[model samples]
Each structure stands twice: as structure tokens, then as C-alpha cells.
Target: MSSRLARTSALTVAAVCGSALLVMTAVSASGNTAEEPRLHDIQGKTRISPFAGKQVTDVPGVVTAVRGFGKARGFWLQDPKPDDDPATSEGIFVFTGEKTPDVEAGDSIRISGEVAEFYPGGEEAGGQSVTQLTGAEWKAASKKKAKLPKAVGLGADRVPDAYAPEGKGDEGNIESLKLQPRKFALDLYESLEGMRAGLRNAPVTGPSTEFGELWVTADPGENPTPRGGTLYGAYDQHNGARMKVSSLLPREENHFPKADVGDELRGATTGPLDYDNFGGYTVRATAMGELKDNKLKRERTRKQSKDELSVATYNVENLSPESEPAKFERLSEALVKNLASPDIVALEEVQDDSGPQDDGTVAAGKTLKTLTDAIEKAGGPAYESRQIDPEDNADGGQPGGNIRVAFLYNPDRVDFTDRKGGDATTPVKVGDDGGKPKLSANPGRIEPQEEAWKESRKPLAGEFTFKGRQVFVVANHFSSKGGDQPMEGRFQPPVRESEKQRTAQAKLVNSFAKKVEAIDKDAAVIAAGDFNDFPFSPSLDAIREGGVLTSPMDELPADERYGYVFNGNSQVLDHAVTSPGVGPVKYDIVHINAEFHDQASDHDPSVVRMKP
Candidate 1:
């Protein structure tokens, strides 16, 4: 007897070939008399299995695929005859411990096991759970080749128009969401979990080189952006339409085909649907089609007129002297070629001279000098750098890195208004100097010791004269959204706890701008940098509450207003908010980075050209 038959005793003899006899049997070594259950009976029409905690005798299915490498070694089986209800899947996973299963594709078998719900990354992660059969016993009913069930089509017709249902239920809780298989894509994916699925001509939205995962959207999706990716709205519903595609075996040969944005995975992408920590419901591919490249190109913003002062903002992803000099050179090229070497550039994340080493050094002079030298070498204007170093490790970033916001001005075009008493802890205040608004301490920190900025980079306010017109510039690097729950987490309307600090920071910046406006109503105040929040977020609203400043992105068309891409959706975290009376500004979110695999920085620089 085979290992499959060693654990079971019940048998039903049947003839497959004329001479070969096949036995469909179920037995329990524990001597418990239990009836056999069908695959559909165990996998009811819900996100979780109906027979999750129960032990069953016989569950018949044909082996469709086998995965032997992972910690949870398992084989996927599909029932020949499926239930009429679309909400219930016909396939299930059978966990076979550390050893590889003897079962092969096309073999019909009957499995007896305890149904269990396994949460990857543990239950504390608040991630989705996978239902499988564990402590299993199985017997091959037929060694003769059995045809596998047809892969369920996941094209536009099969997938629902809406990514998720519109109701009060928890959207992130896949098991709790009211299953509307016909109305929402998320419901359909959840209902079809553990099933063999196929996507036809799915367009790749995000390509992961490290993990070989392809974020794709089936064709006929609504609100398709120009770059062929779906627009992720303020809500999490848009993510439902996008799915991650990977291989069951994490090997070079089995890896998902390389792709970029606007590329398409033509033909069928056949795989077994599974849920994991990285993405909610991912399809572990057994077979993939050819990758069709869309030839996406990087675009450079048009050069600004010499008379128009161009201001730009960029997050340099922690730059320091110890960092790779190649990065500085590449960044210089981006500034010169992509942004036209703006008259003034607000640089964020400039690390201390020693990078992340915790030796208590706070000055970033060497770091800025290296970047400026490279800028000049790259044929850009020689820029003069200005910044007040933060207290060692006081500003939260890479510990001891002392990352802070700074400014680079082209001396030929812009002049920094030098004043006394600018230091790491000094608070710059709006003052009346001979009846005109002036910064008491030029290039000073704005309320550095405030609770909101306790462990965050203080906003660096600088006074500059562009073409003899005085302008106040505030460069900020607000608290990041690090602790926010993932959009695909179990919590509905995923919590963004980082918003509180950012909102408080925005209000402080707004109040400072209001004071400058009070001194001079038409003060050309430009607050620009990585706010670490979206334009539609409450933080940006706080910045715009008093109408002291307005986001220049608001002037751009909705589809083209993004400066960053996260989870395959083009969005903006970098912004330039200017006083109401600034100019008919020409704003461009230069696409040098954020979309490419070889990007120098994670953010694309945003440029605003206006007569200041």
C-alpha cells in the first residue's frame, strides 16, 4: 500500500482503465467514524472555510499543482465538478509538512485532514489568513491521467467594475466583508482564493525587480491613468483592482517576467490564488505569458525663462560625504537636465557628514559641498548652500544622521538675505524692520522645540532676493507616515497615526506664514519640501486653512499632478505651497525618478517657475 493509503481504511473500488482498478478511500487511524465531505462542502461560499476546525474523512480532488519549497509545503487540488455558486471556490490547498508530496498533477486523490486557517507573519501582523487542510491523509484514487479543471477567467467580464463594495463594513477585513462576487473585484478575489485562476492581457502597473512581483490590473479598468496604471484615490478601494503576481517557487527560472509601467502581460497568467503579508490576494503563477513593453520614457521639464525665478524641491534620500559619490553626480544631472537648474532648490534629507554613524557630528557642510561641486561639474550654475544643522540625533531620521532640510541657490540669480543669530535652536520670527516685514534671523528654524517637531526636522525658513524681489522660502521635511497600517491590513479604513504629527506641523507652518502675511499681505512666501503627506490629506488642508498659501499642484490637471508613485499609483508627497499673490506659475513634476527601477531618488523633483 502507498503512503497515501496508510492513514485511511474506508474504500470504494472503481475501474478507471479496462485492466487497472482504482480505489477511492477514506480512513482514520484514530478510529473515528466520520462521513466523507466534498471540497465545496468544506469550502462554503465565504472568505473562510465553513469546516475550518473540523476533521473530515474524504475530500476528493484532482492534483493541479505542487509547491514543495516553502515552509508550508502544499499541493493545490481542484474538484472536477464545481458548485453552481460563484462565491464558493472549487479548489483547496493540502499542507504536506516538510516532506514533498508523492502526488503529481493530473492524479485524482481523496484527502482526509483537519481544516485550519493559517495566518502568515503570525496573527499579530493583522494580515489576511489562508485556509488549508493540515495533518492530512490521502490516497490516490487513480494514477491514470485526469484532466485538470479549466482555469477561471479573470478578465474584465469576470472581474467586477468596482474594486470593493460601497458600504459601512470593514473593507480591509477580507473575511468579514459582505461577499458581493458580482459587484466588487475584492469580493470576487476573496471568493476565489485557493482556486486556479487566469488573467488575460493584464497590464502591469508596478514592476518589482527585487521580488519579481508584477502589480497588474486586468483590462477595462475605470479611471486608467495615462501611464497605464490605475489611479489610487484617497480611499483604499482602488487597490482592489490591482493584484500582485508572483511564482510559487521563489527561483530565478520560475520568477514572474520582468516588466515596467505601461507594459502588459499578454496571454494567460495561470496561477493559484493565495493571500500573503505583502499583498492581500496574490496569484502564485504556475505559468506566465510574454512581457510586452510599452517603452515608457522619462520626461524633463521645460527650461524656465532666465527672468522667471525657478524654485524646486527634492528629497535626496539621505545624502552625505560618506555616501556614494555617484549618487551626487546623478542627482546633479537630474537637477541640471530635468529641472533646468532651478534658481533655488530646497533639498531634504541631507545627512550629517558621517551619514548614519552615531558619533554626534551634526554639520552637513561637506555633504552640501560635494553636491554643489557635482552640480557645477555637470554644467549647472555653481550653487551656494545654506542650512542650520540640527542638534545631534534630535531630528528623527537615521539615528545620528541629523538629516535636515537645506537650500541651494544659484548666486548669479538669487541672493540669500544674511542676518545674525541663525542657529539650530533659534526660532525665526516675522518682525517689522523699519515698517517692512523682515526675518529677525534669516535662515532660521521655525519653532524647533515645539512638541510636533520634537523628533522631526524643523522647518527651515530662509530669506532670499530673486531678481531684486524679496521672497521668503520655508523648506520642510515633515514626519513620515511610517507607523500607518497598510491599506491591505485587517483594519478597515486603515489608520494613519502619523497624520497627527504632520497636521500639527502643517498648522505651525501655516501660522508662521500668516505672520509673514500680516507684516506684508503680499509677501512672496514659498513653502516647499517633502510634507510626507498627500495633497488631499488633512495635513495639506491644515496648511491651506487660512488661505495664506495654496498648493501649486492645484493648478495642474488632476491626472498630472503627481510627484511620487507608491504601490503602483502615481501620487504626490512633495509639494510647493505659495502665497496667494505669487504668480501665474509654471509648475512641473519632473519625471526623472519614482517610475524607473534605476532611480537616483525615490521622489521626483517638483519645479515651480514664476517671477518672484
Candidate 2:
């Protein structure tokens, strides 16, 4: 790695000096060129190394932000898109890197590096499979170059750094599913809250009734695999939760030695980590944070920039608007003030018109509307929202509250197609509980195969066009609590088919892509949303791992890969997978959302961009 690459973080540089199209013969070491290159012939003009190689050239874009993992930091950039998931490179392609920073989201800079692909158990453990932009030597490249391509966009694929293969991206009982409700009603009085670092035994904080609380075996070799032991401090939920942790053992992995015994560890939400001790193992966790009373609370205010948009997501802290319409309105305003309203915002844990008590009120479930109106009233732009009316039968969160997902957008900025309630087949369903399926007369198992469920989560899919490029996006939340078949609790590996959870979801996504292809064989799919799993899980691996869809997130920093942490390890659950012809665009973290979720939601919102 040369000084340019070093200054750019851990990105490897690939060599292809003359691959560029229409470059002047006279070149400088800085590689800064004023002539803009055509993107349609990108394949003929570009070169990328497999790994740890070098690339000699420069692409222009801006650095979005820098997220620190440990020793290395990830540099997420906002590059232009050529076409929606199209490799033709017709427009600016947004790209992100795993190394360091050389640009900002709004900065116009160019970097030339080798692009590589990533696969689970294949290379670099987990990273992008194609165009792993590296060895990036950054400098000012283009300033208002060519017009953006309409169909061009960046890939939206990613890996989970925490809660994975063993319990993510696929179907499994979401222990947190139970805690989804009672956000503020949770009763966790004495457990660790928030991100605690560099310590072994963290003191308990006042309890709150949330869901980060989990169970693990202090002695994996004991008679029962998960015999309860000492309380593992409460650093667990990916977003935030109200948990009850009373037993814990010891762990040799302590990333933050400076983490004290008890200081209400707060920073980016961290751990609920599971460790393997020989054949035996110990389970631990990272608590999002114990409940705290906020008197000086603030919210994220929307800030739009030229040629850029800033969007963030989170399960707002105790802001169940419908639960308490008046209070909800107050919090709604706070949210708009704090979490900036972006061009498009995808959110989960939203309320539907189910009504407070499932009563047959005409407006019983217009939760999204109420909040949307309230947010707009709080000094924001007019936004349109969409969500499934949650099953009235399921006992999720607040009484009759919908555990539905929603996408609110500024229609003036982008175009969205309505696609819901299609009755399309799903590869699998989230287990009744994160346990073994119950025997029934149905052909498909009601419960996710514990073994298979450990891999991934049921995914939600959609597509949106930004500046003319249609990008496919998927939103998901993988399994949170890991356990054996209910009533038959024991640490047991699921049947091989259980791992099929990932395959199932991946197939579903593929099916969706096929549907789009039917509409336009060349249509690019941008699958974006939380996956609830990781890069290596069989679910993600089954996708176009063979030089197909691109995952710009893999090219990002390690710790930054994960939207949230568990027991210390980072997990990337949020993802954006695009069909070919999309991707190679600039990607970056809109970290504003995570700060609001210490007992709020369990995941963060991740977004990607490309110019049309």
C-alpha cells in the first residue's frame, strides 16, 4: 500500500493505468484529470484486483463520513450511479470503502482502485463479491462532470457483523419480538444499559421493561448447555431494549479495557456476544442501555444538500404515537427536530390503524398517518407514508399496535411504485417463537427449523427511483434471541434444512427480482433494508455471490459494517442488494439514527445512493 492508499485507510489499490477511456496522454502522479470519461464502456476501461492488489486510476465522488471500528476506520463515500444496478456505468456510481477517509458525502473527489467481490467462507471472511473498490488514491477528480444516468444506481448488499448465521437473516423466533411492545412499559431495574467497554463484571443499572435481556450458559460444558449462571451485564440489544440480565460468566474478549465496572456505558450500542470455549462455549451480551430520564432531549433535523440527501432510521425511544396520541405527538415533533427528514426514510416498529384495543373504529389503525401528519406539523416537508396494516391478531408491542414496516418519502424528490399485499410466496416465515417449528398439517413448517433459522431472517422487498434510477431495496430484522425448540429448551444444532432459512429468503428475493425482470428483463433490483444477518450466512451467500449483485458495504470499515453490536462483535444486518447494472456508487453511514435508540429500536437505518 502506498502513502495514498495508507492515507485512504485499509483499501487495497489495483493497477490498470491505461484502462480509462478518453484520458489525455499527459498524466501526473496525482492522477487528477479534467476530462470526464464515459461510463457505458466501464468494463473495457476499468480494472480491479482480486485482493490486496493495486489499481492505478481515479474515480470522482465525495466522502460521506468516517466510522471507527478499532484500529482501522471505514470510509463511506457517495459516488454517482451509472444505472440502477447496471454495470454499464452510464452515470455517476456511488462507492464506499473499508479503509479510511479521503472524501466526504458532499465532496466531489475521484479515486482509482481495484474492485473485488466478497463471499462467506470465500475471501476476506465477508466482503463485496464484485467491485471491492480498494487501493483508493483520493484527489479532486470531477466537478459537475457528465449528467447522471437514469437507470444507474449502486448495489445494496451487506453482511451482519453481529447476530448472524447462527441467528440472523433467516427465520427464527425473535425473543425481542415479545419485547417489541412495552417500549417504555418494560421493567428492567438492575442491568447494564448502553455500550460498556473494557470490563468484565459491569454493575447493574435501574431496571426497565424492555427486551435486550437474554439467556446463556455460563458453563457450556455443564449438564445443560445453557445452565443459567451469573448475570452478564446488560450490553446486548442491537438498538435498545428493556432487559433483565441476572447471570453471567467471564469472557477473555474485552475490546474496551478502559470500560469501567459501572458507568452506564454509553456510546454506540454494543454486545450480547456469544463465545466458544473449546467444544463448549459461553454466551454474553451487549446492552443497548438501561432506561434513562431525558430532560434535555433533542431530535435529528433534516438537512438536504445539493446532489445529496441525508436519511436516518431508528426505533424512536418510547415514541409509540398511537399508544398515547397526545404524547406521541410531542415525541413526533421531537423526532422531526432531531432526526432529519431525508428524501426517503424506511422505518420499522411503526403503528398501523389497528386502533388502541382492536376495536372496530374506522380509524382504528391509521397509526402511520397520525405520526406522519404530526411530523409534518412539526416543521418538516410533506411526506407520503406506506405500511401494512399489522395482523390484528398478533399481540405485538402496544395493545393492537402493528409491528409493520413503513417507508415515508418526499414525493417531490423521488418516485415510488406501490407494491404490497401481493400474497407472493415467502421462502419461510419467522418461527412462532425463535424455536423449532410445531408439527402441523401444513406442507411448510410453521416454526423455522432451529438449525436453519439461525442463518437469516424473512426479508421485505421494494424498489425506489432516485433521480430516475430505480433501485431495489429490502428491509429486514433478523432473529434476536438464540434458543432451542421451545418446551424442549437445549443447545442443539438445527437440522441442516434449518440453514435453508437463508436460502429461502434469498430465493424469495430472487423471485422478486424475476418479477421485475418480467416487467423489464434489464431492470436492476436494489434490495435494501435490514437483513438481520451477516455476510457469510448461507442466506446471503446464495445470492449472486458469483460476480452478480454488488455489496458496497463490504468495502466499508469493519466495526462500521454493523449497524449495531452484540456482546461486542459488530454485525451488519441492514443491507442493499442491487441487480447488475446498479452499484459501484458512493455509500456512507447516516449515523444520526443510532443515537436515539438506547432503549428505542434494536436496529439502525442504512441507505445508499447513485445518480441517474
Candidate 3:
């Protein structure tokens, strides 16, 4: 027998009730599921279906929604009569391959198909799986219209504060385990998968994207930041109220609202709860709410005091001279106005003059010159640039763009102590310069040859004299989270495969900071740039492991600690950590980008002020 037959044969039926409407069931069962094979029986109480990998006949439900567009087109089938159990959902997605199913809302139907778990990026990818029926064939059981089941209300009250349940072992796959919808948010969403769901007057936490999607908070009170965003404060807290919003309205209608952060989707937005690879559980809205704009504004950081040496970090998003003049102007204005033109600024993703032209050329002098010139044009200080260009395209970013971290400093405020012998392979070492500490090679790479730095931008260390005091600033752009599995992947807890290298990279940067302080205990060392990880992540923990460096954002209020926004959660990715010697530091994650529709760069710049 075939594998499918063998698995089906494993389930022994005690008896058949009738001939035409045959009811086949397992020998030992809790309820007569065969007699009434509703949507709940297929969904069960767990994430994985109880009848997964087996064939089922005459599963009954009402056509609640139909998805006519997209590669996987199908209609949602929801049972009008629900079971007493809240753990099992009454809805199921019947996958009809590429063709849109010939079905409509309020149609009572009976479907027969193979119950299978659809892992978005495959089971091996370690993402959560969606329980769906494939190769489905259905017939309209009722000629008359059937009432569509009420959409499950999703709000702060329903979705539990806990994010997800831990798996059986380290793998964290909660597929087979029973769901506790009242205790865990993931379980709650899983229980309502493919079911009609609605949120009333939802607050938009993430702005609408070009891809016709936005994110909203079911609970507006959950870890809300000052500027209309849900704060992701810790590892355990992923802001359970966050959910993606994708409109089901036809694209030709042009009815989707363009909303910014803090806006409210007024009235009721109802839709089927669907799962995808990008943002996990989403509300594919059949009835979208009207956009109520709050006219949210951007924030600016205060200027540094005369005695304070301000250092800032900004990822210019692969900036090159070839970029639009508007981009350069906007970035310069942001640096000078929003960020208050800090004394030292660490710029990440500064591409070479050729900007993604994959030739042998790797010089970025013209690129830095354009930015410095723009800053001056913007009525800011005449900032000078210092950066060691990587060898060709060794550092990863855009294909031809030799993106590297570069520093821009006002010569009048600080002096860059440029030492020789710094290159892509050469490591910067800490040395004693008289009574103070100094780098053997200024503007040097930190452990560039290490495997952790492979295909990643190396930390650019530079020595500067701020008011006759030796201060060190390290600019970094660690490995990106390209290979990491999605949070809603097949695995219960998504694996961060890219974090290992980042952790190692963080350790190297930490050791460098420690060495500077080791040579002179009171050395002012500021490590700032695109960390590409959260404050609570292992990489950031490793950076602060030995108490050598401390992130200043920790001092800020939990709600005001974020510098970047992703999906809908306003979180931290860029940071500026200082040594203990940099006393009485002031930091601000200047909100100019990330929250707005029109942005200079995807990331917002951060500034830190300290008396060296």
C-alpha cells in the first residue's frame, strides 16, 4: 500500500452508520467526529490538526470569505455551529491551488480533502505551520443562503499577554501540544486561524507600507511607546497585541487608506485570520475601517552643550554620489537639524563613489565628500570624513556597493588621530600613548579576519581628541538577519541563525572597548552604529558582558527607548553604548524616519552626548 493509504489504514473504523452518507471514524474517540465532521474537529485544540496527513470526507462549514488573488487562492470555510471548546477554531482554509474557488459568502458547503500542515518556508525552516486542507473538492450543501458565523473579536482582552508556548524540547515546536488560548497569544491566534476576526477602532502601530499592508495593536495599552508604537522591551515580551493588517478589498478600487503611526482605523475592520510567511497571523480584512489620521510629527534631539562631546550614528542606506540629490539633501538636513549636528557621527552603509557598480573600484572618497559638502551646504559645520574602504565587495551589502562604516567629524570640535598601517586585514590594537590610551592604527578594523566578520562590515575604530581628552568611537554594521527563520515559522520559537556571528562580533567589539579602558580605566569609549539586534538580544548582552560598555538607552524610559520600527513594533536596532568613564551621558533616538511615510533612510539616527 502507498504511504497515504498506510497512514489512513492505521485509523480503524468501528462501523459505518449509513451507505450514502457514510460515517467512518477511529475505533477509540472522545466524540462522534465522524457523524458531524465540523471545522473544529479538523482544527482540534492544538496548532497541528488531529487528522493531519489523513483523508477526511464531508467536512461541513459555511463559506465565510474567498481569496481570489495571489498564488495560493482559496476560500475560508467556517462552521456556523461551534463547539463549546474555545481552544479549537471553527474555521479552516481550503487550499484550491492557484485557481480561486467557485464559492461565495453565506454558502453552506461540505469539503473533502487531505488535512495537511502548510509550513510557509518548509518544516525545516523552523517557522510555525498553518493547518490547511489541500486538493480540496467541495459541494454546496445548502441551496439557500446560510448565515456567516460572527467574527471572533480580537482585542487586548482576548489575546493573552504571553507570546507563545514553549515547545517540548529546545526545538520549541508546539504543534502536537494542546492550546491554551486564554494563556498564550500565539495559541489564541492559532485557535482562530482562518476564522472571521475583527478589531474595533484599532490603533495603527506600524504605518502603511507600499505593499498595501499595515499593522495595528489589538490592545492599545500594551507597552505603547510615546509615539504611537508598541515597545518591544524584552526577550520574553514580543508585544502580544501586534497583528498585521492586509486589506481584502480589490486593489483596483484604491480604497486602502494611507495611514501613519498613531492613526486609528475607525469603526470595525472584519476579516479572516490568515497566516503568511512575512508577518505571521494577519487579518485579511473584508471590511476595512476608515483611516483617522492623527497628524503625527517627527522628533528632534537637543543640541550638545559646549562641554559635551556629542556622538551620533546613522545608516545612510547605501548612500553614494549616484543617489538622488534629494536623498543627500534630506540626509544632510536630518543630520544637521534633527540630530543637532553631533561632533562625531558614525555613518553605516556608505557605498563607494560607483555605488553598486560591481567593478574593481572600491574607493568611497567621493561619496563621503558629497555628504560632507551637503552638510556644509545645509548650514552645518564643515565636517571632515575618515573611513577605511573595504577590499572590493568583500564586505556584504548591495552586490556592487562596497558598503563600509565611515566617520564624519567637525574639525573645529574634535581632531581625528590618523595612525598608519590600518587596512581590511590589519587589526587595531590598544597601546599607551604617554599616560592615556591610544589605538596603534587609527580608523582601523577590529578583528576583520575573524570568521564572524566574514561577508559583514568590520568595526571601524577611530581615535579622537575631544577637548584634549582621548576618546574612542567604534562604528559597526554587524551581520544582517538574512538567514534567520521568521518569528511565525514552523518552529515554535524561531531560530536566529545569524545571531551567532553577531554575538561573536559583539564580543570582539566588547573586547576592544575593554582594552581601551584596561589601558586607561577612565578612557571615554563610545561604541555606536547599526547593531542589527535588540537591547535584550544575546549580541547586545555580549557587548555589555564584562561591563566594559553600557548602552545609554537603558537609562531612558522603556517607551522612549526605540530607534527603529519593523513590521509594526517600534524597537531598537541602532544604539550608542558608552564606557563608565563617559560620565553623565545624554542620549536620544531622534525620530525622523521609520515612523513616517516619506523617509530619508529606513532607520532613525541616534545621538549620545557626554563630557570626555
Best by lDDT: 3
Task: Sort every candidate by lDDT, greatest first.
Answer: 3, 1, 2
TM-score of each: 0.86, 0.43, 0.90
Give the alpha carbon lDDT tens digit for every residue of 1-612 in model 3: 124323442231121100111112221112223333678998898777777776778888899888776556678889888999999998988777658789998999888877766655444456566677777788889899998888888888888888887777666667767889999888889889989998999999988776778899999999898888888787667888899888767766556788888999999999899876567788989899899999998888888989999999999998998899999999999888888899999999999999989987789999999999999999899999999989888999999999999999999999887889899899988888786887889889999999999999999999999898888999999999988877655455777889999999999999999888887899899999999999989999999987899988989988898877787889889999999998878888888988876778989999999886
Write down the RMSD of all candidates, one decimal each. Answer: 8.4, 26.7, 7.0
Question: Per-residue alpha-carbon lDDT of model 2 for 1-612, expressed as tens digits?
Answer: 124322332323221111111111101122333223322223221211112223435554444333322222334333344333221222222223234354443455665654322111122212111223434466766554343212110011111112111322343322112111112111010011111111222222221112223222111211110111122211222212112232122223422222211123232223321111111111122223232223213223345555554333444322343466664565455456544566666565664454444563222236666777887888877878644333353413445443544566778786766632322132322122122221111112112233333333334444566776655444443433232121111111122333355565565555545544545544555665555456666667665454445677767754355544332223455666666655355555444322222323445455555544
Model 1 off-target regions past 4 Å? 1-36, 66-73, 94-107, 120-125, 135-139, 165-174, 236-239, 253-256, 321-325
Of candidate 2, the 10-residue stretch with the lowest lDDT total is 186-195
lDDT for model 2, please.
0.37
**Model 3 worst lDDT window (10 residues):** 13-22
> lDDT per model, in order?
0.78, 0.37, 0.83
- 297-375 in candidate 1: lDDT tens per residue? 8778888887898899999998999878799999999999878889999999999999999998999999999999999
